[model samples]
Target: MLLNMNFIVKALLGLCLVNSAFSARILFVMIAPSLSHHIFFRHLIKELSFRGHDVVSISPDPMNDPKLTNITEIDIHTETYDAFDARKWLETVQYNKPSSEISLMRSFLPLFYTQADNVLSAPKVQELIQNKNEHFDLVIVEMLMFNAHLFALRERFNCPAIGLASLDTSLNAMDAIGNPTDPNYYGSFFTEFSGGNLSFWERLQLLWHHIDFRLYYYLEYLPISDAMIAKHFNITDKTAWDLEKSVDLILTNTNPIFHIPRPKVPNYIDIGGMHMRERKPLPKDLKQFLDDSKQGVIYFSLGSNVKSTNLPAEKRAAILNVFRQLPYNILWKWENDTLPDKPANVLIKSWLPQQDVLDHPNLKAFITQGGIQSMEEAIRSNVPLICMPFGGDQKFNARRIADLGIGRRLPFDDITADTFLDAITDVASNPKYKKSITKLASVLWDQPTKPLDRAVWWVEYVIRHGGAKHLRSPAADFPWYKYLMLDIIGFILAVVIIALIVIIKVIKLLFRIIPLKKIKLKEQ
Candidate 1:
């Protein structure tokens, strides 16, 4: 019996060792200033910490989670630059140019660089780099902006680097991983084209944007970001352009089931709904609102970035005016307490438990900005949406919503009381909208593993394997002309031309010989 007990103890110890093997020291750099954008990384951090891994996160808004003992938080303040300023983009939208989004990105890159540079230059980051004792198994970076700067962290820790895209339809991340971005298959996040099989004209437009985007990065974004990396990291051996190509994996925030279907490299893992969770109890007030609504509730939110309160007086009135006409009880996520004429049916909250409220059985419709989070929540809950996009991929997501028959997108400039009223009525009254989203939710939930589990597993897989270098596509090494097959096309064209010239010369020589032979025969 004593011998048996000894064996059992040894087995138990082995089990403990096996369990402990999964734990990793991970470095996460999330410099995205936007609150909603930060949530994606926050969920990833939380998941890693729960799995008994040690996570050191550098973020603008750090989650001071006392529960996760292994997680370390380093704060970077970028509220001034990162905070959702609707006014800036709203003015750009007024221009009605397709390139307007590109212009906004150009304006925002300076501020994005400022925050990235500040985080790298922070004393804590510097100390971490200088400390020889500090080591990490992996480094994860949000690839929204400042990919180059975060790569510096990967080198500092001497570990594998993984990029997590903050938004869905990240053409930049797709391009960086050497994933094909053919206009025939993929739509620009700026456009509302559901680009599965695009028309000739549609493909041309997408191609133009594709070419312009490569030019923009090569000419503008990369050079400036390289300067920031050069200054802060003090490394002469590599430029930012070089570091950007070295990422081991890209954790994309996209679900092909919900997104425009396109080819992705094996390294680009889709963990789009990674943040989705089992429903928790709603806040007391929110619960009461849903409980009290006999006719069901309409939840309206522009996500965290675009403040509904930032809407101009006329726009605000237009939205409020629609809510007044709706029969169902309205729950609008207004940033401010007071609005001009909030009807009796409408209830305004500074912040609402968005996921919890979406989970409510009493939810008839969601009036949302086409933020992927909001759309995912609405889809997960199997509720229909009325998408009035503010900026960024909201428009793209909105278009997908409409294309999928899950929602309708009406532009803000054209969003009158009648259009808003009609959209709410159409989505709410139609059972097909709810049905379509429910079908999509099934495919989203029907993954081999839960998104969070897949995400954690991939993260640990990178750790266990030391790095994901094998998954790296050879395409990243190719220049534009080579990757696009332009060189091969040029070579093929030259060969064909030379062959035709040889054939023509042979025909001419044959004719000359035949005529001379005929003359000789006639003389004979």
Candidate 2:
């Protein structure tokens, strides 16, 4: 019996060894120049490297982790800042809005394509690709914007590819993996409607959103991205369209806690809150500030992309006036070195440990820019929010917070003392906001395992199973008409038409042969 037990143990140990032997070499071509995007991809690489996978990460920001042994950080220089200016973006998006739908679509394409062009044009990226001996098992591309350009990397390596989206689940991204975009219920990227029955107008807006986005992609976005990738890579065998279509799996930064109800296939994984980490002790001054506050502390941040310092002087004064009047001590993330008038209650820091601040015991409410990452941290900390969104999916995210009954949206244009006071007071003082936020926090936290663990497991699963092709739906391969069953509908309609035509011909022939006069006499 002892010998039998030993045998079993030995067999299990050997099996473990066999599984551990399959250490993969992964290439993370993360060229997103945003800090939030960089942080998420950096977390992923760290997790993968911790599990003994050799990782080559091409990113603007590098985590020079002495602890992580299996990772190579290739520092990349992208002209994202040179190409796109956030302060300018804020000015245009807020003050001078696009005139038409075409103008809106045209306005946004450059922000993404500029990053694409710059990343591909980077010296290190070109070097990494041109190297003949450097091989990888899989390539993970940060695909928030243009996916087709990065798909060229997969073509070069002849390996499986996976996409990572920094934003919420995108319909175009889902389309790449063959998931259905049921626009009937699925909110548009900016509408940010939570799960509820939509009004007729809302449904029409969704339908129009679907139509407009698809039209924009095909007519304006697709051609530009395709030409860029082809010209840069000298792509010969397949079109840029095929390159994007060949992607195996896409990981979205959306959880059921935050996202509306949408059907996703196996290939589409939700690894939301992967960037979340254990909170560290706050700085001494910050801790003291929070602890000493008679009321609670309000944490305000505009996230990484948009700097709070860029706010016009008048706007700053308006917000400051409100903060001065409030009982709460406000920790504002100000980007500049110095300011003229200092409010006594407001502490202006060029940078902040945002999650730690939100986790404080004296936290009454969060005043935020409605970035998804900040919203996730607030939820995790069970802090209610007063959102002021700028652009992109921030509008949707803010609306979602309001829809969940956990927060209120205050427009930047209307940031007067009274409006700010009302919004902040409502979110902070209300029991319902706390209750709703806490409930969702509990739900979001109650996972089978850590989100990071799930993400790593799926990443390994893809590598182990050779690209998750079985998980890929046939809908991905289908043309638009076939996927929507328009062809099938057309065929059915054609058969019905043919049947009607034959029946009409038979009636006419009978009327010609059989005398109508005799039929009339018989009736008489």
Candidate 3:
């Protein structure tokens, strides 16, 4: 018996050692100022730390949870918020403005550049970067806006890096991972055009935008970012492009149910809705309000970044006018102490537990700005949407909701009491929108692996393999001409031109000989 016990103890000790070896030390950087964006990264960060990884997180929003002992949070919220006032930017957005992706990016680049500089200069970030004694097995970075932090992949820590995006893959992210930017079918977040059935003008506009955006990015944005990287980190050996291509994998927040299906490389993984968790109980007042609403409730919120309080007085009145006439109760996320001229049936709250509220059975329709995360929550709860997008990807997501037959999209600038009432009534009274979204939600939940688990698995896979270099697409190495097969097309055109010339010359010579022979015969 003693001999058997000794053998079992040794085996158990070996397993513990193996488990310890697998736990990685990760440097997770999520410095974006938006809270909605951070929520997604926060879930992943907590999951990794809970799974025994020593996660060092650098973010503008820190969870500061004392129970999460495995994570070391480096806060840069103050500096980042100061650099870019999200609220001011949101307030200034023209809801009626058309999409001009290149122009929009051009205006935002300087702001992002300044924000990146501030993030790097923050005391905690500086200390973390300069600490040569600290090492990590992996580094994860949010690949939106500014990617100056990518310099850490090589210059600061010689380890593999994983790029994370809070929204569907962007043109720059696709370019970095060597994935095809199928602009014809997959119009970017800023553009309303998506899918293959495009008009002649739409096709023309898309192609022009693709070329124009690429020129601006490569010529202007890239050089500025490269200079910033060099100045901040003393990284003279690699440009921003070089660092972008060094990414081992890209995890995008996209799903086939929500985003158009497109070709993607192996390393470009979709872990959309990874932040989704089981619905919790709602607060008593909200719960009672929903329970008492016999006609059902319509939920309204513009999401975290865009505040409803900032809506123009006319627009706010229009929304309120519609709410007053509706038999159904309204729950609005107002983001203010009180709403002026509020309806008796409508309840306004400064903040809401959005997911829990959506999960309530009495909730019928969602009036939203069509943010991706909000759409995911609504889809899961089988709530149809009435999207009035303001800016950014919201336009694309709103258009998609209409295209998918999951709901309706209203133009914010075009909205009035009648239009608002029509949209809400159509979406809430009609059964088709709810049914379509329900079917989509089923598809979303039918995946073999849960999104969070899949994300965690990929993170660990990178650690286990030391890098996902083998999975990197070969197209990443191809230049523009080669990738487009322009060389082959040029060669084929040359051969055809030469053959055509030879045939014409031979025909001319034959005609001349025949005319001379006829003249000679006549003279004889």
> Which candidate number has the best TM-score?
3
Task: Spell out the clash pairs found in candidate 1.
Answer: none
Which of the predicted structures, 1 or 2, would earn the higher lDDT when compared with the native? Answer: 2
Error of 2 at 488 (Å): 1.2
Over all chains combined, what TM-score does candidate 2 have?
Answer: 0.92
Top candidate on lDDT is 3
> Model 3, 90-138: lDDT tens per residue?
4445653425757766777788778878888888888877887978999
TM-score of each: 0.93, 0.92, 0.94
What are the lDDT scores of the predictions, listed in order? 0.79, 0.81, 0.85
Off by over 4 Å in 1: 1-12, 79-98, 517-524
lDDT per residue, candidate 2, 1-524, as tens digits? 99999999999999778757988999998765567778777778888987778999887778887877788887764455565544455457666765533456578687767766877787877888788887889999876545567888888898999998777755567778888777777854555463568787878878877787778766778776787777777886677678887888888778877888677888888888888998899999888988998788888888887788778788888888888888888888888876668788888899889889889889999988887888889999999999998876787888889888889988788888788889988888989999999999998889997878888988898899778888989999999999989999999999999999999999998987689778888999
Comparing 1 and 2 on TM-score, the stronger one: 1
Poorly placed runs, candidate 3 (over 4 Å): 1-15, 86-92, 95-99, 148-152, 512-524
Instruction: Name the candidate, 2 or 3, with the larger lDDT value.
Output: 3
TM-score of candidate 1 against the unseen true structure: 0.93
lDDT of 3 at 515: 99
Instruction: Using lDDT, rank the candidates from best to worst.
Output: 3, 2, 1
